[model samples]
Target: MNTTSTNCYLLAIESSCDDTAAAILLNDKVLSNVVATQEIHEQYGGVVPELASRAHQQNIVPVVTAALRQANIDKNELNAIAFTSGPGLLGSLLVGTSFAKSLALGLNIPLIDVNHMQAHILAHFIDEEGYDKPTFPFLAMTISGGHTQIVRVDDYFRMSVIGETIDDAVGEAFDKSAKLLGLPYPGGPLIDQWAAKGNPKAFPFTKPRVDGLNFSFSGLKTQIMYFVQKQVQQNPDFVSQHLADVCASIQYTIVGILMDKLKKAVKQTGINQIAIGGGVSANKGIREALTQAEKNLGWKTFLPKFEYTTDNAGMIGIVGYLKYSQELKDKNNYIDTGIHAQSRLKL
Candidate 1:
């Protein structure tokens, strides 16, 4: 394997959650990214950890094969392997970690450990045609089912969490709220769709009064649950009758809470460039809000391509390529084969 930057072929595996994903990258450019989503958890309304890990075990081989096949590359041609190491289900991470370590050792290549949250932020750096990357000292807000955080990015590896969720993540709030409304699992996108057709101000939900930059969505979730109960008690068919309005109002309040914190973060950090990542960054309402902020508030907001917003191996691959490049400079970017999975890793 050539260690030169020009010929760097990296394989990245992401089994941080229910999605078993694999990607092949030549340097910073993604050649193939494949994700196998687990639909088994839908019936349960949320991801079951045991079920998720089992699914990963089943999907890892075929997913990686597909990724390499689609990239038109052989496994032995890869120069390095990367895997998400933390801030995810331990069982799920273990599956990817073990595979990555075995493959790297078999091929006599370097193994890289990637931080899941950092991958979400650095995903913006993936070499895409029209997408522009954020420079140093930008603020990144990662919103997903398992995590929600505002980070200050100084470099590819240098980041500090300035604010984060005190309770449930924004994606969980969306899914839980959708569940309360009797919607299907992963209800965040459905709420975004309905919000477009309804009046945002139809029903007002109070935002949680968290000081400074930290967030608390648990109270907001409780508020929505109580509001739904009261409404259904008064009128048995209330949700069915006013589903759109309720969804719009809920989305509006959630977006407002995010924006308020972002504004505070900007004021505190004096950095106007705002970049967002994670699964909830796929929300249409949030995208619209960021676009509006660009025009109305003179803020430069970086929104990732939809594919990179979710849990995918392409993000991991980009991070791997970056780390591999840095290793050429510093020689200390490689990880040991004895590295273990971390269920709770911070920035």
Candidate 2:
């Protein structure tokens, strides 16, 4: 270990999905965050695991180098190297994991393994001038392409997932619904864009009645498919004419389903402070809905900026800094050197 406690520097890498990101944090303050998004995935409706891994191999080195250069820090100044250890694509995780391990070994520094999901939640703690950090025991709704869960965070590492999706994630719902409208590969953003111009109540889609906090979007997805199929058969140009309405209605339903469960979670836990993370948190509908809830319900809500909401190394760096700080508080809390990537590692 470097044993350089003062002015600690950490380099964090995230390759959980198609994005290869790197960030440099100095004493919990992120100085540089660089993300290389794969455009090749735009051709495919969804990510191809093999291609994602290959892209990571090509981007990881340059991304990390750029991050360090931007941060105006030398590799030798890094006290520890942190990398996402999973709850992500196995192939993608390997590229980051291998790079982190090699760098730590070369520099004779400590290696910190971060859980991607946990990183998303802890991202709120990344040092920002005006951003407010959520208090302890706040509820964090992590919604993204691959995962969706409502978690109760008692501390940095102590989190309990109270609710989660049983089938497809909300991001998938948006994308799949967009595909039905003949939208491109990443239909989620398009849906959001079109939804902005149309009436949310123009069309009413059935929302699945899921018990408790566990969600089921498969039924809602099927409902959209059947509805679209029927409309297309009647008028081949239906999608073209009603694109905005369809997007608005779909976004409305998805946002409603999420908000309903979030309200229930707050009622159940009695913890009013709500925070959201992950990529889907960037949706305007969800953000507006949550903000409205705060006004009507007198709840404190935390929403990260657009850049931090997505899969990026800034979040990973925050987790790394938190974990390192925890270890410093108690040597017994130190991360084991044998830590390895886990595709389904729980929060």
Candidate 3:
């Protein structure tokens, strides 16, 4: 699509997982971001693909409507429709993809495809009055339920995955650890909350010695499991007695692992600018850890607002706006409207 106009209006949809989110972007400004969370998965302990997709179907329309209403924009004014196209549950991605395609076609607008993982990184650019955007050649560490990666972003579309988890992501490690402690679904946040009240060094857990920036959290999970089991054997109420300590120790280990890798990336890439995105970034421990890095390591950090930190359409709209700007710069930079949802799409 080619547009010589400025301040283009974009409607973005995100149903990559359990949340059905919609947002409106006027140029780089995010006017509205509405996410309908799926609490139905709470009882199940994790997201159930089938249930997530079903909930998305039920929430998409109203979510989009609310987003537009909040943004005070009409569908007819949209220059394009952007939607997350991959690296998510196929069923969930399809819900957003189908809806975006239909709406784009109905309004005769172009369809913009966004990678779920990339959106997590580009989320740093979502408009905030005084927020400073990260310059190119920066390192972006995206830690989420499905991904943990260190990316070298040279430009809008020029990104390279420098390192990533070979097995489980940091978010999974947190949630799984919480499960071992009898916490509820999406226990990552709960762990963070409790971690605040306990000593992070209360318990000792061996950190994985993975070479380079590649992460391995499966072993950490196993360590916690066995440790918890042994404690329970000694005392049936061990978890209940030390819930806060357990959470703090676990969060401490995870944050250390992440910060160590981030420091290594900075040293290896010589990129002083570091940014983090995804749901895991919302953890208070991780946020403080990263903030401390700026003072100790002379590094500049970018952290998105809590709302944009999680899976949301506002991030998708940022990508759409970037791609649209590319088209404006060079008409030959045409985006493929023929794109489809890719469940395992790479960043």
Candidate 4:
């Protein structure tokens, strides 16, 4: 039974997937953010969810300690604990959610529930001190490894998915294509690097069949597979020799597909302010596309600098700060240890 109105420091933990991350955010100021990524799973050609969970169990504590140290705060000075509650690996989310709840109960402080994807959008605000922040009624495109969606964000906590994938997500498409090309498990970054050197027009890929603002990447991924299979049949060294070109071709096609829907979302939502978030947003091609859209469509665009585009606990902490400022948090928000992860969540 803790009820206090005093200003406080927020501790945020994130174990939604392969990374175990933690941070300390005071108000809207990010004091420290530390992340521990599980590198062992890379050899498996993709994340093994169970392995990711085991890694979180092994890494959560040290990561949190590092975050607290970076923030220069002792555990006793903390105000409340915040963590991602859903839309991630159930086992992974449980690690952070349960830890946060237990810590809050022990410290007699409040707890905040954070939506991982929403935090990715709000990541734009972390560490920004007294700077201009996006107002209500803006558009956010959350493109990550597992999910791809364009959302209408009317406020920090109030959002709705305007459009999304009918099949594979953009990031998943990237990794899957990379795997076929004999690239590593988390092939998104590999695709980006390879695309940088290759000609984007080298290989042609068809856009999705879905209309309007929604997205579909399954067809494009299939096209790449068949295209590559034919190439390999002719020259077994095709991917090895033309890796850059295939990456360029595939990356270009994917970015083009996203831009098509992004433009429409703006037109239909009638919101000129657009923002891009998530790991895929870190791609240089997407950055260039958004910049072009800004100039061509006369729309205001924001892409968080490359560092903030990926999964990080600082974003969760920032969202926690926003909710705290709005008086919308409670210790009771803590997990019951029976929580689950949702592969998808609205806005």
Candidate 5:
């Protein structure tokens, strides 16, 4: 496994969730990234793990094929295969891990395992024009449907989690609040859209008083549910009448909670450089707040491109390329065939 050459082609697969994705990376640059989102979970109001895994089983092959075709690279040209191996649904992870293992075995290339959360942070390292990579000793906040954590990143593979959610993640809080408002599945974005037109202070919600940098959103979700129930009981048309106001207030509170913790992380670590990732990082409200922090708080914020902010193989490919490059110095960068999927992996 001598990858001393400048050109290293890697195929990355990501099925850690409902999206079945694949990407081709030439070193640190992405050639093509393909994602097939599953809409089957919409009827359930949230992701059904069984349905998600089934969809991944059906989409993985075509998704990988499409990625290769889009990259104009033959499968034989790949030097390594990488797949997300943990911190996701067991069934979904197995689909990707099995495929990546078989592909690497057949092609006789290196098989690399990527931690999903680590990929979210390292996505910043992708060689994208106009985007500056964060230097070492930066704070990374990963907010997603299943996770919420603030990490201390010292190097490419050196990371430590400083704080995390004790209960529901911030994304869950957003989606669950949207559900209470009678919004459709995957409703976080819709709330953001409506919040823009309404007054964020129209209906104020109290931010949870959690200690330290750790977060707790389950209480906030409960508060929203109770408020919605009481309002609807008094007036059946309350939600319809105050939809925008409710959305604005909710978004404002959630953003406040995130910013508060980030401020604490910075003060505790004395690091002004901040980076955010995961699906929720794409929220307009969060992005706006981070941008404002740049001007108001004098904090250096790093945001990934909209496409890389979500669950995609482009991020996974970047991690793969990074790990492959590290293999030259560390012989333990590759995974054995006995490697299995992990549903809960920490950074």
Candidate 6:
């Protein structure tokens, strides 16, 4: 992991979930990010762990090959292989971890074990700088399918989760609400689309009352469920005709809860630098709310581009590249069986 003599080219693998993504990031700038999504799990209405593992088995090799091909990089030239190590489905993480280790061994290169959640936060550093970089002592809010947290990012490799949800994540809330509205799998995006057209105040939902900067979405999700259930029962055409209003109302409620906690984090931490990432960062309502908050509060804000907003290997590569540059190697990267997946990891 002594990187003074190391090259910057990295081959990253991300199979923390249903997406088997591979990419060649050159000096932290993505050359090709090839994500092989699992289409078979759509019928399950969400990610089916077993089906995801099967799809990863079918996609890893081809996806990695395509990434290298697209990046125009020879296997021998890759400086290292970075793979997601935890905070994801065990079966899926194992698929990417095993493949990356083998490829690293075959190429006689080193393996960089990446924390999936940390990668999501580090994603804000890709292909952009200046005010775009969230400065040290900054507050990082990561919202994803399974996790939501406010972190103190002192540096690229040094981060600490300061506040997090006791129950559901923002993305999970969106997906659950989408299910009740008859949306397809990964319905978060569909809800965002619907939210764009409706009035946010159309329906009133109570915000969570966590004591500190931490967040809790379980109650809000349950409220949405009951509200939708009753509304749909009262009028069968509720979702069909009033989809926009329903989506807007739900989106407003969630975004409100998220930003409320974020503002409180800013007040307590006294950090003006704020950055938002993860799959939920792609949300329109959240983006607008954060932008308006910046305007009202005079706090600086940073948002990753849409492409880097989701789970991807490119994010891992950039994070690995940062750690590699400062010789910040993992202390425990040598164990063979230690390459297994973890459902949670502290940054």
Which ranges of candidate 2 are over 4 A from the true structure? 1-5, 329-337
Cα error, candidate 6, residue 114 (Å): 0.3
* Candidate 1 lDDT, 3-93, residue by residue in tens: 5445789999999999999999988999999999999999999999999999999999999999999999999788889999998999999
Regions more than 4 Å wrong, model 1: 3-5, 329-335
RMSD of 4: 2.4
Q: Extract clashing residue pairs from model 3.
A: none
TM-scores, each model vs. reference: 0.98, 0.97, 0.96, 0.93, 0.97, 0.94
Model 2 RMSD vs true structure: 1.5
Give the alpha carbon lDDT tens digit for every residue of 155-265 in model 2: 888899999999999989888888888899889999999999998999899889989998888899999999999999999999999989889999999999999999999
Which digits, one per residue and each the tens of the lDDT, describe model 6 over residues 137-237? 78889999988999999877778888999988889999988998899988999999988899889899999798887788889888888988898899988
lDDT of 3 by residue, 41-113 (tens): 9999999999999999999999999999998877888888889999899999999989998888778777888
**lDDT per prediction?**
0.93, 0.91, 0.91, 0.84, 0.93, 0.85
Measured with C-alpha atoms, the lDDT of residue 8 in candidate 2 is: 69
Off by over 4 Å in 3: 1-5, 329-337
Q: Candidate 4 versus the native: TM-score?
A: 0.93
RMSD (Cα, Å) for all candidates, in order, is: 1.2, 1.5, 1.8, 2.4, 1.5, 2.5
Question: Ranking by TM-score, best first?
Answer: 1, 5, 2, 3, 6, 4
* Error of model 4, residue 216, in angstroms: 0.8
Per-residue alpha-carbon lDDT of model 4 for 1-347, expressed as tens digits? 32365565889888888889998987777788888989999888878889999899999999999999999989988877889886888888878877887887788777788889989889877767443466778999989998899989887778888898888899999999999999988999999999999999997888877977789888888888899999999999988999999999999999999888887888787898888899899989998998898898898887886656787888888888787767655444543444444544455
